[model samples]
Target: MKLGELFQEIPMERVHRYAPERSLDLITNESKACRPGALYVAIPGQRVDGHWFLKEVLERGAEAAIVQHIDESLPLCQIEVPNSRRAWSALSAVYYGHPSRGMMVYGITATNGKTTISFMLDSILRGAHHKPGLIGTVKIRLGDELLAAQMTTPEAFVLQRYFREMADHGLDSCVMEVSSSALEQDRAADVAFDVVSFNNFSREHIDQHGSLEAYWQAKASLITQASSKSVAVINLDDARIRTLQGQSAASFLTYGIASKDADLLAVDLQVSGPTVSFTLLIPRPVYLAGVDRTVPAGAWPMKVGSPGQHTVANALACCAMALAGGIKPMDLAPGLLAYGGVERRFEVLYHGPFTILDDHFANQSNIRTTLSSLSQMDYNKLHICYAIRGNRGVIVNRENVAAMAPFFKDLRVGRFIATQTLGEVTEKDVVHDEERAAFLDEAVRCGLAPELIPPLDEAIEAVLDAADSGDLILLAGCQGMDLGAGKILTLLAQRHPEQKAKILWPLNDRVCGQTIPHPPNKKETQQ
Candidate 1:
C-alpha cells in the first residue's frame, strides 16, 4: 500500500514531512518491530509513550511515522495527528482493505455475558449456513481455526488482521466482544458494524477508566455511533442501559424478561437442570436474517442447553442480533440449543449424584446473577467455595462480599468457604492483607461468618468432603478460581474411580485457561 493511500480519510493536525508515493511493507506501533519500509504509529500510553521511542524507531529504519507531537531533530517523514491511537485504527483498517465492511459484523458490549453471546451468535450464523468468525475472551475463531485470545477485545492492528483473515477466507460474518477499555483507547474505532448490542452494565473497570461515568460513556459509544442502517440491541430491563434510549440513530431492538415495552420478551421461562426454556414473544414485525424478509408478530418456544436467568438474557440478545442480520427465527432454537456455553460462566463440571458448578464471580453484578440463578435450582445443600478477590483493591472486595450477603440470607446457604489462594495465583493477583480484611469484615457484618481456607486445593477438597447426594457445590472467583474446575474434577475422579472417564472426558478437550500463548514483548505488552 502506498503511504498516501493509508492516510486517505484520516484527519491530521499537520504534516511535518510527506512521502505520498512511498510504498510501505508493514505498519506497527512497536519501535522494535519497525523495518526499512514500515510505518510506525506513536501512541501515548499510561506508562510509556510511543513518541518517546521515535528516535529508536527511526534508527531502526522505519520509512515514515504518525505522531501526535513532531520531533524536529528526527529526520523522518512524519504525519502529525490530533490523536495517534485513532489514526492508527483508521490507517490499519484501510491497510487491511477495510475487511469488516464486506461481512455482517455483530458487536456485543456489556459488563458480562459478552463471550456467551458471541458464541451464541456464532452458532446461529453457522446454523443459517453462513460462515462466521468469533472474537471474544475465550478464543478467536476464523473459520475452522481457533486461536487463544489475549483480551476481550484485541488491539486495533491485531483485530483488523483477524477481520482481514476472516474476510479473505470467505467467511460471511463476525461476532466480536467489544470491551470498555478497547472503546476508551479507540481500538475498535474504524470497524464497520451491522448489529451492536448493549446488553447491560454495572460498576466495573472503574479504576481502569478512572470513574463510573467514563466507563459508561465508553460502553455507550458503540451504540451511539452505530450507523443508521445497523440495529442497536438494548436491554430494557437495566435502568442504566435504558438511558441509551433515543440516543442512537440506528434501529432499536429492545429485549427483556420484565419490561412490557420490550420489542422481544422472554415469557414462560423455565429453568430445569441443564436447560432453560422460554417463549420468545415478538410483539411486532421485525427483520428476519435467514429468510431475508420481515417476521410478523409471533411467539416461538426457545430452549437453550445452558441454564440460568442470565443465559436467557444472553439468548435474547443473540436472537435480536441474529434476526437483524437476516437469520430466520426458526434457526434460533437449534443454534442456541447446541451452544455448550463458555467456560467459567456458570459452567457445570459434574452432574452425577451431586452437582459441581464453576463460575468467574468477579464483581458484585456477577455475584448477584450467579447466586440468583442457583436460587432457582433444587439442592440439598449449597456449598460456596469463594476465592477471595486479590489485588483488585479493598472496595471491590468489600462490594463483592456485600453482594453475596443478601443471597446468603435468601438462599439459606449451607456453607461459605473462603480461600486466599496463597500459592496458586501470580504476583499481580496475590491477595493483600487489606483486601482479605475487607472481605472478612464485610462478611461478618453481613452475617456470612465465612471460614478461612488458605490454599485453593484445600478449599476444593473441603467442598468435596462436605458435598452430599443432593448437594450443589459452587467453585467461584476470578483468576484464583480458574484452576478450581480441574482440581475438583480430579478429586471427584479419585473418590469415584469407576466413573473417572465420565467425570473428566466431557471437559477434556473443551476446558480453557490451560493454553499459554507466546509471552508478549515490551511494546506489545504496553499496547
Candidate 2:
C-alpha cells in the first residue's frame, strides 16, 4: 500500500519524500517487531520513545517511518503526523482493510462485568450461528482457538492484527472488553463497532486515571464513539451510566434490573443455588431470522447460570446487544444458561458436603457484591480467607475494608482470616502499612474481630482447619489470591488424598493455568 493513502485520515504535519510505491506490508511501533518491509511509527510514550530507535529500524530495512517530528539526520522516507498514536491506529486499520467492518463487534466497557458480558455475548452470537471471537481480560477467542490475554485491551496495532486474523479465520462476530486506559491510548480508534455496552461503572483505576471523573470520562468516551448506525446499550442501574442518558447520538438500548423505563428489563427474579432465573420484560420486539414470528413482546422466561446482581446486569446488557443486533430473545435465553462462566468470577473451585469458591475481589464494589451473595447462600459455616490487596493505594484499601466491615459485622458464620500472602504472591502484591492500618481500624470500628495472618498459605490452612463438611470457604482477593485455587487444591489433597485425581481437573480451569492462552511475558503468582 502507498504511504500517502494510509495518511488520509491522519492530519499530516509534513511529508518528506513520501513514497507512493513503498510496499509496506507490515506496521509496528515496536522496533523489535519490525520486519524488512514494515513501516515503523515513532510513538512518544512515558517510558520509551520509538524515535530513539530510528537508526535500528532503518538498519533492519524499514520502508518508511511516521513520526511526530522529522528526523533530519536520517534520509529514510518519512511521514510526519500531528499524533503518532492516532496515525498508527488509522494506518493499521487501512493496512488490515478494516477487518472489524466485516464482522459484528460488541465493545463492552465497565468497571466490572466486561469479561462476563463478552463471554455471554459470544455464546449468544454463537447460538445464532455467528462464529464469534472474543478479546477480553480472561482470554482471546477465535472460534475454537483461545489465547490468554496480555491485558484488558491490546494496543491498536496488535488489536487490528488480531481482527485481521479473526476475519481470515472465518469468525462473523467479535466481542471485546474496552478498558479506560485503552480508550485514552486511542487503541480502539479504528474498529467499527456494531454495538457498544456500558454495563456498570464504579470507583476504580483512580490511581492510574488520577481522578474519578477522568475514569468516568474514559468509559463514557467509548459509548460516545459509537456512530449513528451503531447501537449503544446502557445500563440504567449504573448511576455513572445514568448520567450518560441523552448523551450519545447512537440508537440507545437501555437495560436494568430496577428501572421500569428500561427497554430490556428483568423482573420476577429468582435466585436458587448456583442459578438465577428472571422474567425478561421485553416491551420492544426484535426480529428473528428464518422464523415465522418475531421474538414476541412479552415476559420471556430467562435464566443465567451464574449468580449475583452483577450477573443479572451482565445478562441484561448482552440480551440488549443481541436484541439490538436483531437476535431473538428465545435464542439468547439458552446461550446465557450455556455460558459455564470464566475463571475467578465467583467460581466454585471445589464442591463437596462443603463448598470452596474463589473470586477476584479486586475493588470495593466487587467485595460488597461477593459478600452479599455469600450471605444469601445456604451454608452452616462461612469461612473467608482474604488476601489483603496490594499495589492499590490507601484510598482503595480504605473503601475495601469499609465494604468488608459492614457485611461481616454480624459474623453470620466463622471468623474472617486476612493474609498478607508473604511467599504466595509477588513483592508488589505484598500488603502495605496503610492497607493494614485501614483494615484493622475498619474491622474494629464495625465491631468485628478478623484474625490477621501474614502468610497467605497459613491463613488458607487456618480456614481449612476451621471448616466443617457443611461450611463454605471463600478464597478472595486481587493479585495475591491468584494462587488461591491452586493452593486450595493442594490443601484439599492433604485433607483427603483419595480424592486427588477426581478434583485435579479444576486446577486446569484456573486463571493462572494453561486453560487460557496466557502470554509468556505476563506475570504469574510468585508462588
Candidate 3:
C-alpha cells in the first residue's frame, strides 16, 4: 500500500518529507523489527521511548517512520501524529485491508470473566457451524491453530495480522477479550466489532491505570465505541454497566440475573460442583441466524460447564452477544456446556480423595466471588493456599486478603496460607515487602493469623499434606499460582502412585500453564 493509502482517514499532526506515493512493505512499532521498506512507529512507552530508537530503526530501514515527536537533525522521513499508538492501530488495519470489517467481530471486556465469555461465545459460534476464531488471555485460535497469548489483548499490529489471517482462513467470526490497558493504549481502536459487551467491573490494575475512574473509562470505551449497526451487550445486574444503556448509538441488548427489566434474564440459578445450571428467560423474540428464523419468547434451560454464580453473569453476557448476532438460542446451551472452563478460572485439578481447585484470585472481587462459590459447595474443610499477587501494590494485596478473611472465618478455614512464590515469578511479578505486609496485616486485622510461605513448591506441598480426605484444596492467585496446580498434582501423584491417573486427569486438557516449574528467574525477591 502507498503511504497516502495507509494514512487515509487517519488524522495527522504534520507531514515531513512528504511521501504520499511512497510504497510500504511492512509496519512495526519495535525498532529491531524494522525492514527495508518498513514504517517504524516511534511510540513513547512507560520506560523506554520508541523515539529514542529512531537512529537505530533508521539505520536498519531505508524508508519512512511515524512519530509523535519530530527530530529535524536526522534525515529520517517522518509522518508526525498526535498519538502514535492510535496511528499504528489505524494504519495496521488499513495495511491489513481492515480484516475485522470483513468478518463478524465480538469483544468482551471486564475485570473478570472476559476469557470465559470469549470462550463460551467462540464455542457457541462453532456449535452453530460457523468457523470462529478467538483472541483471549488463555490462547488465540485461528481455524485449527491454537497460539499461546502473551497478554489479555495483543498489540495492534499482531491483532490486525491475526484478524487478517483468520479472514483468509475462511473464519466467519472472531471473539476476543478486550482489556482496560489495551483500550487505554488504543490497541483495539481500529477493530470493527459487530457486537461488544461490558461485563462486571471492579478495582483492578489501579496502579497501571492511575485511578479507578480512569480504569472504568478505559473499559467503558469498548461499549461506547460500537458503531450504529453493531450491538452493545450490557449487564443490567451491574449498576455501572446499566448506566451505559443509552450511552451508545449501537442497538442495546440488556441481560441480567437480578434486574427484572432485562431483555434476557437467568432465573432459578444453580451452582452444583463444576457446573452452573439456570433457566434462561427470553421475554422477546430473538433472531437465530443459524436457523434463519426468529424464536418466540420463552424460558430455556441453560448450563455452563463452569462453576460459581459469577459464571451465570458470564453465560448471560455470552448469550446476549450470540443472540444479538442472530445465533440460535438452542445452540447456546450446547456451546456453553462444551466450554469446560478456562485454565485457572476455578479449574478443578483433582476430584479424587480430596478435591483440588485452581483459581486466578487476582483482586478483591475475584477472591470474594471464588470463595463465595466454594461456600456453596459441600466440602469438609476449605484449605486455601494463596499465592500473593506480586508487584500489584499494597492496596490490592490488602483488599485481596481482606476479601478472603470473611469467607475463611465463615467456612471455618483454620489457617490462611500465603506464598510469595519466591523464585517462580518474573521480575515484574516479584512480591514487594509492602505488598507482603499488606496481606499479612489485613489477615491479622480480619481475625486470622496467616501462615507466610515464601516458596511456591513448598507451599503446595504444605497445603496438600495438611488437607485430608473430603476437604477442598484451593490453589489461588494470579501469576504466582500459575504453577500451583501442576505442583499439587505432581505431589499427589508421588503420595499415591496407584491413584495418580485419577488425580492428574484435570491436567490433560489445560490450555494455559501446562508447563511445570515455570523456569523461575533467580533474580526475583527471595523473602
Candidate 4:
C-alpha cells in the first residue's frame, strides 16, 4: 500500500511529515517491541505520555511518529493529525492492509449484554462453519490464540492490527463489542461492518460520557457510520431502537419479544428450569432466488448455558443477526440449542446439596436481572456473597447498592456477605477499606445486613459455611470473582469428595482457581 493510497481514505487534506519515505513495517507503543521502519504513535496518557518517550522510540528504530504536538527538530517522520486517537485508527487500517474489507464485521454495542451477544454470535458462526474472530471485554480470540483484554475495545491502531491478524489467519468473520468511548473517539471509523446490532442500553458510563444523551449519541454513531447496503439489526423492545432506526441509512431488521410487528418475533415463551423454549414467528417468506421459501414458525426448544431472561433476549438478537446475515432459520434452532454461555455471565460454579452461581453482574440492571432470574429458580435459601467495588465512583456505588436493596428486601436469605476489592482504582478516587465500609454501612441501613469482609476468599468461606442442602450461594461482581469462586468450589469438593459427583457449575465446566492481586496505586478523582 502506498502513502498516497492510505491518505486518500482519510478526510485530512494535508499532512505534515518529517519523514515521508519511511517504510512503515508496523505501528506499536511498547518501545521494547519497536521494529525498524515502524510508526510509533505518541499518545498523551495519564501516567505517561508517548510524546515524552519520542526520543526513546526513535532511538529504538521508529521511522515515523504521530504526535498531538509537533516538534520541528525531530528528524523522524512526524505526522501531525488533529487527534492522535483518530490518526491511530486510520494509520492502523492502512498499515494492516484494510483487513476488514475482506471480512464481515458485526459491532455489538450496549450498556450490558455486549459480551454475551458477542460470544453467541461467535458460537453461531462457528456452528455454521464460518471462522470467527472475537474482540470483547473478556478476551480477544484470534483463531487458536487467546489474550486477556486490557479494554472492552482496544485503541484503534491495535484494533486494526488485530483484525489484520485475524484476516491473515483465514477468519471469515469478526464480532466485537463496540464501547461508547471507542465510537466517540472514532476507533472503528475506517472499518466497514456487515451488520451492527443494537442491544438494549441504560444509564452507564455517565462519569466518562457526562450525560445519558451523550452516551446515546456515541452508541448511535456506530449505526450512522455503516454503509448504505449494510444491515442494522435492532431490538424493538429497547426504546432507543426507534431513534436509531431514524438515523440509519442501512437496511433495517427488528426483533423483539413484545413487538408483534417485529421482523422476527419470539412467541409462546416457556421458561423451564435452565432451558427457555419459545416459538419464533417470521411472518414473511425469505426470498431465495426463484423460490419464495415460507419459513415455518414453530416452537424451538433451546437450552442456554446460563439461567436468565436477559440471556433469552440475547439469544433472540443472535438469531435475528444470524438470519439477517443469510443463515437459515432452521440452523438457528440447532445453534441456539448448542449455544454455551460466555464466561462470567450467569456462570454456575457448583451444584451439590447446595448451588453456587458465578455471574459478572457489574451494573444495576444486571444485578437486578440476575437476582430476578435466581428468584425464579427452586432454592430454599439464597445466600449472596456480593463483592462490591468501591472505586466505581460515589454515584455508581450508590446505584449498585440501591439496585441490590430491592432483591434483598424480597428474598429470605441465610446470609448476605458484602465484600470489597481493596486497592482498586477507578476514574474517581481509590476505593480503600474506609470507603467500602461506608458503602456497606449504607446498605445495612437500608435494611440489608451485609457482612463486610476485607478479602474475597474469606467471604467465600463464610458463604460456604453458612450454606447447607438446598441453599444457593451466588458470587456476583465484575472484578476477579471467577478465581475466588473456583477456589471455594475446589476446596468444597476436596472436603466432601462424594458430593463432587453431584457438583454443578453454571455451564458444568471446571473452575480454574487463580488469583493475581493488583499492585497498589494512587487514585485520582474524576474531573
**Which candidate leads the pack in lDDT?**
1
lDDT of 2 by residue, 351-414 (tens): 8878889888878778888888887788887899887788777778777877887777444668
Number of backbone collisions per candidate, in order? 5, 3, 1, 5
Q: Residues 1-527, candidate 4, lDDT per residue (tens digit)?
A: 34444555655433455445556556666666565756677778667887887778778777677788777666666776777777878877886788998988888997889988998888878878788999998778777767667678887767887887789899989999999988987788877788788878887777677788898889888777767767777888888766677466777777888877777787766775676767777776533221222234444445555466777789889887776676766676656767767777787666667878778877887888888888788888888887676455556666777888877756667888876644332333346555576667678667778787757678878888988888888887776464565657667877878766554233243322322222221110111
Ranking by lDDT: 1, 3, 2, 4
Candidates 2 and 4, the one with greater TM-score: 2
* Candidate 3 pairs with clashing backbones: 289-326
TM-score top scorer: 3
Put down candidate 3 lDDT per residue, 375-481, tens digits, no spaces: 88887888889888899998888888777777766785744689999998888889999999888888878888868889988888889888888888888899888
Candidate 4 clash pair list: 19-77, 348-505, 348-506, 349-505, 351-504
Which 10 consecutive positions of candidate 3 have the poorest summed lDDT?
Answer: 518-527
Model 3 TM-score, all chains together: 0.92
Candidate 4 vs. true structure, TM-score: 0.87
What lDDT would each prediction earn against the true structure?
Answer: 0.85, 0.79, 0.83, 0.73
Task: Give all TM-scores, in the order shown.
Answer: 0.91, 0.88, 0.92, 0.87
Better of 2 and 4 by lDDT: 2
Report the Cα lDDT for candidate 2. 0.79
User: Taking the tens digit of each residue's C-alpha lDDT, what string does model 1 give over 354-441?
Assistant: 8999899988889899999989888888998999988888888989988889887667567789999989887878999999999999
